[model samples]
Target: MILAAGLGTRLLPLTKKIPKPLLPIIDKTLLQIAIETACKANPNIIVINASYLSGKITEFLGAHDFGVEIKVSVEPDILGTAGGIKAVEKWLSKDDFGVINSDIIATVDWDALKKIHKNSNATATLMLRDNPDPAIYGPLCLNEKGRVIRIVNTKNRDLSGAEPLLMFTGVSMLSPAIFERIPAGRAVEISSEIYSPMVKAGEPLYGYVTQAEWTDAGTMENYHKAVMARFATCKTSIGMTAKSLKYVTIRPPVHIDTGVYIRAGSTIGPNVAIHEGSVIGASVILKNCVVTPRSNVRSGAFLDGEVI
Candidate 1:
């Protein structure tokens, strides 16, 4: 299941027109990237929960046949993470199901996770990484035996930096038993509600630690950082610039896409991205900025850290 019902308040203006799940990451939306990552595990059906701008997500997923059955659960009222999953309690009656966040960009060894999950016969297996800067994300503490003992603080508010905590990657495989633990019609989070209570009850909750390529592109700063990291790793793509006029000069580390027409004698990049459908005029200098799709950067414009 793809948890994608957040309002994405951090990435305003950009998300004002589109939901964060649909935000572009190079050639694809964040949701598409997540789905691709989940495809590695290859489940029979993929369920996505949608609330904000459900129409666009519905249309986009419909247009692309991922060669697998896709089920989108539209939430009339934006239920929090746990409630959102509870909303689809009927569809997930099989063994265990994997859940991935729509805004998460990562590639983990799905086979390894499944092997451990099935071998351990755990009720829920959280994909955890070594906690980095405990302030940004709270810790998911585990016992010496790798059982998740507690999850303290949160990405949103983490002033108390706890120790011996691994970071939850917003990815997990859960048993159908979790549905029974949640109270019906109440919006709750997995960490505070389910995992915490499970630990108290001494349930078979475990953590699978791995070093995977992961990032949370849920905010502007993190989005920029994730894209920059993608550039460094050669995972980013530069789209076609107008070669007819040859008015383009792209500096190092930039990801531009289709419908971008660069006028003659314009210098772009050195940390810039001209998203699809953006027009760059002559003598425009774009550095450390993003020209969003459908935007027109006038002639002789200079921008940095500003999204057009």
Candidate 2:
């Protein structure tokens, strides 16, 4: 189950216009990344649980066709992590399944996670990563056998005895048995409601450690960083035939979509994404911003934040 329903209150103005999952990092949305990653696991069907502004999500899905069958579970009201899972219990009960958050960026090795869970006979296996300061996130303490023994302070300090008090990587594989532990109908956090109980019950909840890069792009600063990181990693440059006019400065790592017109003396990018049909006036400086489709930026303007 892919959780795509959060309100994303932190990313105010940006998310107000577009769902957080739909916000682009480079040219791809977080939802697309999550869907593609889950496709690698070869699940029979992919389920997305959506709340706030679900119409946009539904419209996006309808416009684009993904090869696999996609199912959406709409929530009348916002449901917490565990509640969302409990809501989808009927669909997931048939077999072991994976759960991921839409706002996270990670290359999850679903096959490896499945193998580890099956071999260890664990009810659930959480993907974990080592964080230098676990205080920011709740830390998971594991015993010698790799079973989660305790959840340290919510801040995740006191890591002396814990070899590596890892943070949850926002990815996990769970057997249908997990539903038996979670109560039906109500809001519940996975960490506090489900994980804590399983650990206290001595039920095996294994941690699969990985060094993969992961980021929670839920805040503006983090979201901006994620966009820059993706741009750095992208090998394909934007194909643009439009000549830069006299005295116009063109910086590296900018993606100027087709049919975009830039007037004389315009400074575009060090980091910028200009969508199709955007017209930039002379002497305008656009940096680290995104000009939405067909928008017009007049002359002598300095646009830093995104242009919507």
Candidate 3:
């Protein structure tokens, strides 16, 4: 299940018109990237749950065929993570399923995750990573044996012997047993509401640590981080094709989509992404920001660290 139903309150005005799932990450939307990631596991069908701006998500899904069968479950009211999955219980109850947050950019080894999940008697296997900072991003404690013993302060067992805290990557493979654990008919987060309690009960929840390329693009800073990281690694990335026009200076690591025309004397980038249909006027300067689709940056403007 691709969890796409959050209001994305952290992104605010950017998500006011475009839902978080449809937010562009260079050439593709977050949802598109997530589905492609899930396809690697070769599931029979993929399910996306959408609430805020459901029509747009629905429309976006219909525009592309990703080879694998895809279905959208529109929630009239925003169902929190666990609730959203519970809403689609019928479609997912037959087998173990993988769940990913649409706003994250992660290239988890699906085969490796599946291998460990299938080999264990775990109720759920979460993809965890070394916590960059436990103070900022809450910690998930894992034991030397790979069992997830605590989330934040919620502990399944005494944590005196636990290893260093790890971060949950918002990716997990779960048994059908999880459905029975989630309550029916309400909004609730899977972490605090379900997993924390399960951990306290000593449920067989495990962590599958990975050294994958991953980032949560749910905030502006991380969004910029994801874009910059992609620019640095992807040699044939969309940003590489942004050529400088006569008198226009385009710094490296700038992604300009199709149909965007920049006038002369414009300085774009170092860290920037201009989406489709945007017009960059003469003498405009843009850096460390994202241009939403079809935006028009007027002549003689200067913008930095602003999502326009």
Candidate 4:
């Protein structure tokens, strides 16, 4: 299940206009990336849980033709992480499935995770990564055998024999058994509600450690940083039969949506994307930003943050 139900309160004014998952990082929305990543796993069906601006999500997914069956679970009221799982209990009952946070962008090895889960006979297998600073995301302690012993605050330096801390990577393989552990009709966090209890009960919870890049774009700063990072690696290309003004300076790695009017002396890109119908003013400068459709950037303006 792709968890996209959270109200991204941290992303404030931007999220107030558009859902966090729908916000562009580079050129594509976070939801699109998550869906594409999950598609690589060859799952029979992909279930997405959406709450904030559910119509936009539904419409966006509907427009795309993903190979697998796509299903959406709309929550009338917001449900915490664990509650969202419970909300999709019926769909998950069909098989042991994968759960991922929609906002996290990572290159996960889904096949390897599935293999490890089956081999370990674990109720749940969590993807873990070594983190230098555990204070921000607490720490996951593991025994010598690599079994998760507990999650503890990094401030408690008094705790002895604690191995190097690892942070949860927001991706996991879970059996249907997890649903049995959570009570119905209550909002709960997956970490605090389910994982913590399972650890205390000595239930088997395996961890898959990898040094992959992961970014949680839940805040404006992180969002901006992530977009720039992604743009840096994107291949530069100019679409076939596209027109460009002689005086316009477009650096590499930019995507100009069709019908965009980039006027003379305007500089776009190095890391930028302008959606359709956006009129780039003369002498305007846009760097490391995204201008959504139908927006107007007046002349002599500098746009860095996402413009909608």
lDDT of candidates 1 onward, in order: 0.82, 0.82, 0.85, 0.82
lDDT of 3 at 105: 91
Root mean square deviation (Cα) for candidate 3: 3.2
Model 2 stretches astray by more than 4 angstroms: 155-163, 235-248, 257-264, 275-282, 288-308
Minimum summed lDDT over a 10-residue window in model 2 is located at: 235-244
* Candidate 3 wrong stretches, greater than 4 Å: 154-163, 233-247, 251-253, 304-306
Would you estimate the TM-scores of all the predictions?
0.89, 0.88, 0.89, 0.89
Going through the candidates in the order shown, the clash numbers are: 3, 0, 0, 0
**Poorly placed runs, candidate 1 (over 4 Å):** 153-162, 232-244, 252-254, 304-307
Which candidate tops lDDT? 3
Q: Candidate 4, after superposition: displacement of residue 291 in Å?
A: 3.3
- After the best TM-score superposition of candidate 3, give how far the Cα of residue 135 lies from its true spot, in angstroms: 2.4
Question: What residue runs in model 4 are displaced by over 4 Å at the alpha carbon?
Answer: 153-161, 237-246, 292-298, 303-308
User: Every model's Cα RMSD, please?
Assistant: 2.7, 3.0, 3.2, 2.7
| Candidate 1: tens digits of C-alpha lDDT, residues 1-308 | 99999888989878888888988765567899889988898898889999999998999998998988899889888888899999998889667899999888888788878877778788889999987867777677778777887777464554344466679899998888888888778677888888888888999899999888889899888887766566655543576834543657778778787777888888887777778788888888887776667789899888876666
1-308: candidate 3 lDDT, tens digit per residue: 89999898998877888999888877778999999999988899999999999999999989999998888899999879999999999899999999999999998898888777888778899999998876566688877677888787544333454458688999999999998889888888888998988889998899899888899999988876776676666442343233546677878677777778889888988778888888999999998878988888999999987777
Model 2: per-residue lDDT, tens digit, 254-276?
87777778888889877788777
In model 4, what is the error at residue 16, expressed in angstroms?
1.7
lDDT value, residue 36 of candidate 1: 91
